[model samples]
Target: MAISAKLVKELREKTGAGMMDCKKALEACDGDIEASFDWLREKGIAKSAKKADRIAAEGLSAFAINGNVAAMVEVNSETDFVAKNAEFVALVNTVCEAVAANNPADLEAAKAIEVDGKTLETTIAEASGKIGEKLSLRRIKTFTKDDNEVFGAYSHMGGKMVSIVKLADATEEKAKDIAMHVAAINPKYISQDEIPQAEKDREDAVQTEIMANDPKLANKPEKVLEGIKRGKLNKVFSEWCLLDQEFIKTPKETVAKYLGNSKVLEIARFQVGEGIEKKEENFAEEVAAQMKQ
Candidate 1:
């Protein structure tokens, strides 16, 4: 039984596998196009498994909104080059859409979602094989708001950063402005009230210790020191809390003042590759390895 070039071409078209891989599959399956397709898929799954341990910290953060519901997703690839691929971008969009539509409870649930009749996890595995890298759905989040609330979404640097904000009784423009501010400022909390008591206590202790260490403050009354500590704490909170920070668009007003009658209900921000430790390659070693190959 001979494998024909035509058969290899057909398999490549079907699976997007390389020409050499397609030929190998055709040969292994005795030129049966259907079997060869399956063979290629199996090979791809194997490739994906082999690359699973590789770090894939580079990719995109994308969001999809449907009516009052919005979903944001981060998809990772091994290299920035692959992150820019149209296929990779489309996959990110599809995952975002699926999460928005299905509102899966968790990351695993989102991965188990069906896309074009295939599980999203399986689809990612297949794509990893075709793209010659490990691909993963890093995170998924969804926000839902009632008719009285509005959802604002923004993506920066293509998809390097994404932010979504839910606002109650806010105009669309204001919502988008707040989302853009969140993306730019990277606020830790919506307001001072959202800060945990333990965290506040810790900051107060730190500031009080600083004041005690100061020579001039050593002679100050306890009441004066307490006021100074409060001021310092407020300054720190202004940086960490969104409502206290000056609005990006209007420097004079804080986000709290900018909102006027509206209130920020919830916010989600994703910075691509935020926590993943990327592997640094030695140029000499890389060149030597490539030369060896």
Candidate 2:
């Protein structure tokens, strides 16, 4: 069967594959457009799988702040090259802005929120079709404050990661400083209470194991062991707790004491491309495969 240009164009539009590849597939399928699409899907899926294992650490972290509410997120791509793409960066910014404006609880909800004439999910789909690469909305975290506190936000490594800090009585300068600190230090939780009880229990168990391992502990009293365990627990708590962390700006003081009168509470969250896993590409493998071709 003779292949028509229209069939090849239709297949190319649907699959984002090269024009030559589309024409070949259409010819192979005897000008059956639907079968050509299926053929392309099968080939793309296999090719995409070959690149799935590589780590995608490069992407964009965007921030959207509106009054007392702020949303910051990370959207990762397979390469630093994609991170520099203006369209990808714009998509990331739009998603972050949607997160702040809508305060969606999860990715599904955020994708459903409308932007301009289309929903976020539709926009991402459109981008994917245009860019010929996999694009994703990786993560979204929203923070809201009811008091006079200012929200601080920062993006580091050209948007690969971001951090936001919420201060109850923070001045604009202090808020910005705190945001920078969070981006640098990346504390695990806002406060000690925010740490899960399971985590605390796990730390306590590890402390008990350490105490049991000591030879001198054979003669020491149980009360002394209890005191040692408490000290270990306190150490673990302090390491993970934002307030207990040493202030990045002023290491001389703990975060709790650094901003004394402001009563700073880091209602902050840092997300780096949560849920988006990039398909990895191996240059050597790709070369080998192309050689076979």
Candidate 3:
């Protein structure tokens, strides 16, 4: 059967496949539009699977709060452009809403929750194909508190950074301020007391190694060296710990002092592209390879 230009154009419109790919699919399926569409979807899914191996270090970290229930989520895309897409942002909102409403124990449970009558798995697949990139619901954190606790959420830099804090006094204004600080400063712990023993041990070991290599410190007494180490630890906590960190807005006071009667029960922060290593693209080489194809 002879393939018509009209048939190829119709296949392209329905499948969003390239002109050549649509023509090929139409030929392979004997001009059957439905089979051609399926062919394009299968090919797209395979392409997206390959893209899945690519580092998705750029994306948005978003939050949605409903009254006393709050949820935060990070959705990853291969490029920053797709991360800002309206559909991608809507997916983030749906995931956040699912978490806030159901408080799923983990991402898998969250995936099962329906968003607009579709599961997250289907949403991710459709978005991945439609956007021509890998899409992932990377992580989620949800909190539900009693009447005494208030939830504060902040998404900074258009969700490149996100934070959620639980406050004791239910003061929404103060809680939001604290959440903003959490997003901006990137605090490691809510308070000095919350700092992990392993972290303290690591810092002490680093300081000990530094002192060992210093000739001037060799003559210091063991007690004096120990005191110095403690001092260094205190200084680090003051900078890295949330409660002890100097308030960015009011430098004269620490975040703890700024909080006054409102105490932070919990804090969570997410920064996009935190640990994923990105691939270096050589556009010239890429274009050359595509030209060959």
lDDT of candidates 1 onward, in order: 0.88, 0.74, 0.82
Q: Which digits, one per residue and each the tens of the lDDT, describe model 1 over residues 12-126?
A: 6676655666776788888888888778667575467567679999999999999888999999999999999999999899889989999899998998899887678777878
Candidate 1 error regions (>4 Å)? 1-43, 285-293
lDDT score, candidate 1, position 179: 97
* TM-score of each predicted structure versus truth: 0.83, 0.74, 0.80
lDDT tens digits by residue: candidate 2, 1-293: 88788887787667665566677678878888888877756555223323334565667888898766788877666667877999888888888888888888887788778899656755665565455555556677788888677887777777766878777776878778777877777778868888899988888888888888888787888898898789889988998877898899789888778777776565555556555554566999999999999
Error of 3 at 204 (Å): 1.4
- Better-scoring candidate (lDDT), 2 or 3: 3
Provide C-alpha RMSD values for all models, in order: 7.9, 8.0, 8.4
Candidate 3 — which residues are off by over 4 angstroms? Answer: 1-47, 284-293
Model 2 stretches with alpha carbons more than 4 Å out: 1-57, 216-218, 274-293
Q: Compared with the true structure, what per-residue lDDT tens digits does model 3 show for residues 56-102?
A: 87888888887778889888988999988999888777778777888
After TM-score superposition, what is the CA distance of residue 16 in candidate 1 from its true location, in Å? 22
Each prediction's total of clashing residue pairs, residues at least 3 apart in sequence or on different chains, is: 0, 2, 0
Ranking by TM-score: 1, 3, 2
